[model samples]
Target chain A: MSPSPEILTPERILEATEDVLRRYGPTKATVVDVARALGVSHGSVYRHFRTKAALREAVTARWLGRTEELLGELSEEPAKTAEEKLRQWLAVLFEAKRHKAGDDPELFATYGVLIQEASGVVDEHLLVLIGQLAAIIGEGVRSGQFAARDPLAAARAVFDATARFHDPVYAPQWERPEIDDEFRAVCELLLRGLRA
Target chain B: MSPSPEILTPERILEATEDVLRRYGPTKATVVDVARALGVSHGSVYRHFRTKAALREAVTARWLGRTEELLGELSEEPAKTAEEKLRQWLAVLFEAKRHKAGDDPELFATYGVLIQEASGVVDEHLLVLIGQLAAIIGEGVRSGQFAARDPLAAARAVFDATARFHDPVYAPQWERPEIDDEFRAVCELLLRGLRA
Candidate 1:
């Protein structure tokens, strides 16, 4: 062992892996390359994560975590009326997705390619997001701002209803001049639909 | 020139091209293969469609036309209330999508692959479906059963809102046991939203 090789922590491995992924893309990026970037052996990296799939999951989860944290603030905010909160939440979500799809298209494409292979991380991320929407709707129902029988179900409905604005499959349409107008129109209809 | 080359027609060529697409799939099915399937020269196919792209566009449009015709009946139905028409319309749309996604996954996938290559056929198809939706919403507004200011905009909003139920990207989620429940719940909320 070289005298005091930099400490092998999961955090360091993840950062290195993300860097390697940025360079080689999802398809060509390998655990060994990540290990090389970290100046450690592949076995050292695997000690923290059982498999490459696990490592990928951790990385994706990390990326999605950022978005969730940002939204979590809105979900927990106590001041805004539910209508205002819902509108802000959705606009922020759409903007966040647009930035992800536009800012670093290469990284976004890498995530798109790797997402299928990452397995439950994406599903879990979705559940977390839907849960956030549920919390807001639950509050809306409690305050008599919405008339839904079930906040969880209502949250899911709103989420599904706005899929075109946020779903990666429709990302190409985001560049159209009328996307914002369409988003607002949908939001208006949904807001009207959800009002008590 | 041959005495009789089976008297090729555009309809017959389209029928054979559909068969070839079903057999070889979108990626592998070419103009030459379609021509070979028709027992004619590629030049003969070109004479009708001008280019291979034109042939692909024609085949995709024909397939989409079937769906448009199916929904057109519901859009024009004058007997039912707007609410019932909307409910029936959504259910029928969901069921149709489910059948397309579930009945013959290979054929569905072939269509999915070919769709990207078919240019504006999918967009035109979307406009047709949205127009059907607008017709129903317009009647609702005129009857004072719905409060939407712009029926066309409301139709688009509703269409985008229901993307999860019909969008091919979410096709895998259609298999979930809870999908029907989720769809109905969304429909209920949307109906409530649209009510005057």
Candidate 2:
């Protein structure tokens, strides 16, 4: 069977760790659990991650990285006006978070605990998101679409302002019937604010 | 001894509960602890609060009530222009939250947990705050100081937009030296958007 199919890659470990986390949550999940799922010894997991903390952090980074990649693509999409891009970007973020919260509640709850323990990963993720927003705002400023003097500040403001729709703290409210209307209203106000 | 000077009123019970919460945090705090601090029987506390959950919820509502009263006064200040009121209102919120998070971190941490457990109180607090914002926005629109179709929608947008400055989740960054500058930029952007 091609030497047991070599299932000890970092990617495999992370995937298995995610499963273990989803099953047992962050508090109860362990490297041994991850190793067991992969049919490998705990020593092999240690060889890859060094410690349980390292493995958890890697999982958090990976999860956040997926969101960054998704939003990054929207920020980079050419041809669309900055205004359109900003709207789409915020919409996607809200939708993505809602999906995560709604579609896979078990994994989402696990990540919530993991995030509290991995502030470094959360901070890095915020920086990347803010950077993407700044890039889009910079485009708007240069194209004379937005009149803001500081793109980065503007980006941060936009991020902060729409946080209710995206922040995990308000995740319970995201599924409410009026959430889409509320999201659109906030976006419209922001777009109006950014207009030159 | 002036007939032992009854100090077992509901107000006194709440005060003692707050002390107990500050000392032991939300999870470990109990009505018995509050009674112990107040030098009264737990039965006395129960007579005032009905149940431990009721006591905790009352304490949370009281804590949130202070902020609401503070902001409500600002919204009611008839002399100031809407723009000025909005500026002061947002500034005060950021300051108030920062002070709570900084001045008494132990209590702040306790309240953080309590607030999560007291969502009904929290939701009511948010509604009152938003209602006050809508009232202010309605006045601004009527005075021709701002251009907005729906005062409530505008108010919600403004609240969502400034959440980063005041939301408890971002309290850790509130003490950053540059936060004031960031706050100002957002206010400016929103004010510019609102100007008729």
Candidate 3:
């Protein structure tokens, strides 16, 4: 009925873990629950991810990886100016975070706890996001559209400055009617600061 | 004696409550403990503050009010240009947060929980802080040093933009060696954005 133990893969294990985490929430979810959902042994799950912590971290990574891929593709659009791309990037980030927070609040909250536990995974994810931000700032600098001595530093500043819109800590404020206005004001000011 | 019932004022009760919270934390601290600390009865404490929740909110407001007063004074410096005052205001706010988080970590953590439990107090605190920021920006607008049409809106934008430096959620990151540089970069960009 279920896939053979020999055919079990890391991707399949991670998929099962995500659903298990959402259903049970992060605190109550266990490796055995994931195994039960998959119709396999916990030992088989451990074969793919050595420990429960490791398995949880892998699930967090996979979830974050999807966002990274989507943003990475969005940054590659050649038709838009760098400023346009940067604005779009910020808006998309805020929307993604808002949708995640609003669409499935239970899973969003579960990941919030998981994020605190898997700091290494989160740190790596932040670095990738910053890298993507830096690339767009660098493009603007090269095109004489933005003026910054260090694109990386400017990128970090921009990212930190906009944290209110995307930071999970402020997710409750995301649904406020004035949130879009606040987001736009921050963006306008930052773009003016960056313009050559 | 430890002040008669007639003299057991709200201020004295709040002072005792702050000490008690620091010692036992927000979750464990009780009105009975505050009363004991002040050599008074629980009924006496309740007379000054009707409920445990009310007492904790008062303590939180008193703690936040001190910083608000300090920043309000700094923003009123008549001799300094608005830009200098703005830069100094941001730096001082960061320093106050760093000191609070570092000086007595136990107390800092106790208040962090207390703050969450007392959101109304925090919201009022934010409004006062934003008003102080708007006063400085209003001065800048008059002197032709900044370019915002609405000082209140700009004040909110500035406050939200630099949240990473002063927000309690980011208190742990304040001590990073590179945090100072990051602070400077964000301030520089923001000041540039505000310049006329």
Q: What is the lDDT for A132 in model 3?
A: 98
lDDT of 1 by residue, B1-196 (tens): 8877698888888999999999998888888998888877899898899888888888899999998899888867678999899888889988998998899999999888778887589989999999888889899999999989889998898888998998777888899999999999888888888999
* lDDT computed for candidate 3: 0.91
Write down the worst ten-residue block by lDDT for model 3 chain A.
A1-10
Give residue A104's error in model 1 in angstroms: 1.3
Off by over 4 Å in 1: A1-5, B1-5
Candidate 1's DockQ is 0.85
* DockQ of model 3, rounded to 2 decimals: 0.86
Best candidate (score: DockQ): 3
Task: Quote the positional error of residue A142 for candidate 1 in Å.
Answer: 1.1
lDDT tens per residue, model 3, A13-95: 88889989888999899999999988898999988887899999988998899999989999998889999999999999999
Q: Which ten-residue region of model 2 chain B has the weakest summed lDDT? A: B1-10
Error of 3 at A123 (Å): 1.0
Interface RMSD of each: 0.8, 1.3, 0.6
Q: Return the clash pairs for model 3, or none.
A: none
Once model 2 is optimally superposed onto the true structure by TM-score, how far is the C-alpha of residue B96 displaced, in angstroms? 1.1
Tell me, by lDDT, which candidate is best: 3
